[model samples]
Target: MLQVFRKFFHSSVGVFAALGLIVMLAMAFAAGDVSNMMSSGSITGGDRVAKVGGNTIGTAQLTKQMQQAVEITRQQQPGVTMKSFLAEGGLDLVLDQMIDGEAQMAFGRKVGIVAGKRLIDSELAKIPAFQGAGGKFDQNAYLSVLAQRQMNDADVRDSFARDLVSRQLLAPAQFGAALPQSAVMQYAALLKEHRAGSAAMLPSSAFAPKGLPTQAEVSAWYNSHKAAYTVPERRVIRYARFDESVIKQSSVPSDAEVAARFKANAAQYGASETRKVSQVIVISESMAKDIAAAVAKGESLEAAAKAKGLSVASLGSVSKADLTIKSSAAVAEAAYAAKAGATAGPVKGALGWALVRVDAIDAKPARTLEQVKGEITAALTEEKRKQALAALTEKVNDDFGKGGALSDTAKELGLTMAETPLLVAKTPAGMGLPAELASILPAAFGMDHEGQPQISELVAGKSFVIFDVTKIIPAAPAPLDQISAQVMADIQLEKGSVAARAAAMKLLAAGKKGGDLAAEVAKLGVALPPVQQMNLGREEIMSRGGQIPPAVALFFGMAPGTTKLIPIAGNKGFMAVQLKAITPGAVAANDPLIGQVKGELNNLAAREQGESLRRAIRTEVKVERNESTIKTVTSTLAGGN
Candidate 1:
């Protein structure tokens, strides 16, 4: 969503992105407490990573944030590791964000900007993490999260307060900031620029050596790349589904119970009558009489009222008592007294004198107890069934709480216990896993190996499942001998990739030396795919939707008359891309796209200006780095010193 802004302010956007990052980190810790995700042994107290103004950033704090950063990254890249994250500069990124946040807080306080407790509390309440099932800020839920994270109210409040203060200091800096149309036009033209290129794939298999890879080569490759072949952990779930049928309590209502229920709701079964009527009110009795007389003398009440400069209103299906409450007792009596289709009266009503015309009369004769017996019995049975089901579920939960086993419960209740095939975190299509079981996988995966049985409602108030993790297959690499054939094939593919890259580099070099790309591709004796010609505007590529192919992306990124090798993902091959022509994009002053681009760029400009202000503030705030402690923290998280 902020791609354009990030591009426009690449040097300064990290602080802006950190604004959201702090809130996310705070919310995540309060929500799930990912603090326990890493080993506690990595943490050593009393070391400071950095000092912003007078406040010190602790080693533990930086480590916690890094762990959360890794967990958040894993949502998209599940295979991410602490070592890989740090290798990609994740530690510095997280620590820098922390420093930026602390700088904002220090600067705000230095200038006497105070985030009041009530304001901080209001912001805290808005975090979905602190909310409950009712979607409201729940005090118990908040306290429970604090307890779980081993944090106090003060700890949670202080974090939220920092965020609130930062916003207070930064929001106004970018308020309503915008750029002129002339400034946005140059960037918009880049989107309309046209480019043409030709690309050819160099498949490594064409140049690959004949025959199988040596056994030693396969073994060496497998040993070095074993992590790639490691299977993710899987769990086997054993469960028993039980509903009201498994409960021994009777749900059927006896005759006496049904009779008592019918008696209690006697008025509901009694005879009743109502009339749908139309009425018009006038201040004077004379006007009311005129309308009523007109209505009786072959004119519809609506037409009569409309002619008198009034509108008739329908009182839909009102009984006498309801009509009396709405207008007057006299109006009600007159309305009910007249038969269907008859005009009632110029009666005095609470509103004024009224003319009432009956539209329809509906009546129901009272029903005897026998006539309603079946309905009453059914109602009683359903009520009893729900009560019994609730009790059974409660008992099952209580039993589970008391260290009861699911298998023992199934045997006790005469229920069948079933087991699922080893399952991963995500359900695959055609797995035929029951939807109820699928819904509980997150909870299941959260449990330890062979954790205690838990009772979960499959269908609220109707069905439930008692399940436990019976078998856990830890993630480990398959032995080389078990996958020897696959390893040999992979070794061959790697050789092909190496050969293909060589061919791609050769072709690229030839093109750079003023050789024709198509002619050079033909010279390669290997069976090659035909060269693909592409002519497209940036707008045209966007219109095709989805991701632009990598080779095409490389083509657009290149200067005209340059050749580059684009490596294919998964070691497939490479596409040697050569840019042949460039057509500059033109935009007329009156183009509507100019206005759109102007608006989008203005918002991005405002955000960039806001981030620029934050950067300026950080500079003003005296920030001191303890480089040795920072390295120690990162090294510890990477499983080092």
Candidate 2:
């Protein structure tokens, strides 16, 4: 238990260190933007968002923490935008985490859990982010990093102190969790248990109405689900692109240039001499001499090795430079001197003594310049184009800095300026953008209308683009007249699914009452698909065949011979499940699996206990929240204001 607590404490401290590094990097990157936003009065004027006991969580502190969290999330999900993060409740999650941390700190202070200045200083010294090139704590590097992030030394020390206090307060809950042997064994057995069951699918298409859906029915369905039919907001962008391929055709290398290139890189166009050799290494010089003598007597190396309880190794085709093994230079020299089928060597090696045999020799072949002219010309052309593109990129960047229009720049540079089709954040296929441009969809769509042009690399560094959004098309529902056919089809599918589910239920009920399921299905004029045997857990069963309906998971806990009706594929079909057999897994009391299960359960219990303790502390201590201030901060961080 003490070991567990020690491990947890170390891991928690490591996490705090990582978070601190992220905070520094994020603050540095977002300093200018955050300063501008704050100056614009985007955030409501308030010194603090919440007060927990005597500890006040200031708005500036919360905003800084939120920025760090956002940066970490961005690293994990490369293309995530602020809007998507807010929609996913990222702000709420960060707020809860901050509040919890403050609650823990407050409780620690009340209980006299103090982190001394000496401990805090020691931790700060050990952080790699604060270290210099020599891998030792450098006060200059530490101060420089803080200055870049607009943070001072006192702010960092305070943060470290709070982290230590929180860890100390939560140590008891994290370390006290333990599981009984019986519970561990039971959980392990449950995880190992496997059940084999069969299911028959009843597709909705089999029960689809022969008649078309009425106009009224289509309209009714459309009215109720208007949001589903709405097209998401999209953007039209105008951009100028430059790549290696865009370099002038006249820039092709001349024959003289190609010849010079080939001459300069002669080794690349010539094949080196290689030898096929076999060797037998032994622990002693006598053993090596005996093996060489055996080979000299026309005995095969393999046979000679077997007689000496050793193995012969084939070096395959290798050049002199490829012989990298210890003492291989002498081995190569001897092997190359020997004629094919000749045996040589009783030479000492790093491992032992060696006997070598030359199997075959391949001579070097030099390629004529004409034979590699095409490759050389292509390389030269690529180099010239890269240089030209770099110059063009620099000019375009200068123009952009001076507020020159992209279209005018494109015209001046003889580059094409084109508008992209209305593109969504995901940029679905058939939008007609080049494959390379597809990668920039997230950046393009995340921009506001008429926002500054962003430069992005495409095809690695070989290509570059400068683009700006030309128009924004807000999301709205399509008119009924435009998608009446699709709406009617959807309505018909829904009705068919309902009918299929009813038929499946009837079959299940009949089977439970000792009636034949297949016969009953046939009576409804529908033929059930053959039963498929599956051994799966709840999640696996639910995800089978693209998307399995939630109802099928009920069979996981059912006994053998139980019958159930389950919807399938999100209203695309229905299924009748008959539990065929259950196989009990044998779990030993002393099994390693039991220990693993116990460890997982203990970790979960510890996390839950920590959460509960935080909640209890929050309730005991008075907490005052400024709701309007939090709203303003949340909006500002989410880029809504």
Candidate 3:
């Protein structure tokens, strides 16, 4: 049993249980002949959608699972409508997963692989989400989490039992998977291979003539790409903010009240003495006494331990209240009484006898009421101000609910009202508004243009705002005259790029026919670019003096001496690349890369084997479809009348 747990922990399933649970749930709900099952209405024992060996899944069970899936979907996406969920194939997926889970469970039962109550309870206790404040399993927390997902204790236990049995049955595939050494070496070599190449850059600016585009050309370009120039619809918002700063200074607590408050929480103002100590725990009192004596003779506790084949562990700094270990109270009392550099104790502890040495004392002085009066007053004032702000925020929300105008509400509440400039969906940085308001822009844009005013929290509840969309500006293309200068520049650059490409092609043709590249470029009144060698790999491309152009990195897939023209940035130029050589990187048989590849390959094989086993079990199981029940459930969840 111990070995089984050990093997399960070392397997892929154990390491990825949390992620795998979600995936398994999805798959369990997404399998089978869902279309046919949804078409039948009066389903009896004959309505079994599937029978794994002797176990049958009837329409009633399928209906229950579908309802649970709907609840789960609602919990996952709070505001998702039924239509949207079904449109995304959520129902179909759920049915499939349910069929798959039932098939697996039936197979497990057939093979006598059942999870006992003890195992189920043990696994439940290990889930961190079910633990509470004291770090122990809390029944209330466990029930609450399940309730949130519309799941009960039995449902959870059953799911976990199925998962356990499935894993146990599939253990052989997961534990005994490995990849061939040759496959590992081949993958490693491919990943490490590098290529060398040279490139010549042709800049469009060198070929562009000084001129503006003809009227016909400009109109044609604008007509063909009007969508690119059109702006998105934008909104102008007006809002009124309410915060603690609006609270009156006269509302602050008086000095007497501050002193009274401090008195009520006196323990918070008190301090406890902390001592830094180190101790060596040994099996016997005589051993502890010998170590204490050695320390008294000017030998360090660490040196004493090393001589005795032991180690000293630091207790760090701790107060008396924090000393919870056995005999810790006695150790703390002894160490606190002694001055710094003092040694004490061969004290008996739960583990063994302990030898303690005091390193330092930190005596925190108690703070007087007068010393903390300002802090208490400030805190009380802030609390009162927050209370006032909360009330004001509620009042603002009430006013908005009553259909009060934003400007009128600001006037009535005495809040500062302001209007934002026309803003797009994506708010740019450095906008006048604070980050909190900027974060709300996306949500605001998603709302109906003429929707009711919204009250949003800001600065993590420090402030609040009641905002409404004041106006919406429809998107339109800018006038041609307004952007004529930029348009003319673009036209010139386009013409320049065409000329540059033509010149590059001419040089390429000449070079291919044994013409000197430098001489050919010189004839066209252009300087020939110096050829620089580069080694390109998956990581990056490098030359002797600097990094090569990223466009030349594509040469890695080309054969040696192959040539191609790759585009440069901004539609402004092209880089003519010539592959010079290919070099395969050397990878040792025992390299870490080879091991990583092997691990991934083995994981893939394990997954395939598990799938095959599941399929085999499914094939042996008999299945029947009740199409009417499925269609009824699907129609109801999809909001059909």
> Which is the better candidate, 1 or 2, if ranked by lDDT?
1
Question: Model 3 TM-score?
Answer: 0.60
Q: Residue 352 in candidate 2 has what lDDT?
A: 78
TM-score of each: 0.62, 0.58, 0.60
Give Cα distance to truth, residue 20, candidate 2, Å. Answer: 6.0
Q: Pick the candidate with the highest TM-score.
A: 1
> Per-residue lDDT for 1-641 in model 1, tens only?
12221232233433333232433353222111212221222123338776666566677777877887887577558899999999999888777767776677668778998778888677656655566665688899767755655667765566566656666787798788888666788878888899987889887666667899888898889889999889889988888888888878778899999889988999999999999988888889888889878877899989998998999888899999999998899999999889999988899887788888899999999999999999998899899999988877788889988988888888988999888888888867337458756777888889876958898988878888888999898999988889989888787788888988888888989989977788888887788889888788998887878788888778889999888887778788888888888998899888887888888888898889888987798789876677878888988999996
Higher-scoring candidate on TM-score, 1 or 2: 1
Order of candidates by lDDT, top first? 1, 2, 3
Instruction: Give each model's whole-structure lDDT.
Output: 0.77, 0.71, 0.68
Top lDDT prediction, candidate number: 1
Identify the superior model by TM-score, candidate 2 or candidate 3. 3
lDDT of 2 by residue, 259-327 (tens): 889989988888778888888889988888888788778898889988999998888988766754534
Candidate 2, run of 10 with poorest lDDT: 28-37
| Candidate 1 segments exceeding 4 Å error | 1-193, 203-208, 247-249, 274-358, 429-432, 545-547, 584-641
* RMSD of candidates 1 onward, in order: 10.6, 12.3, 8.6
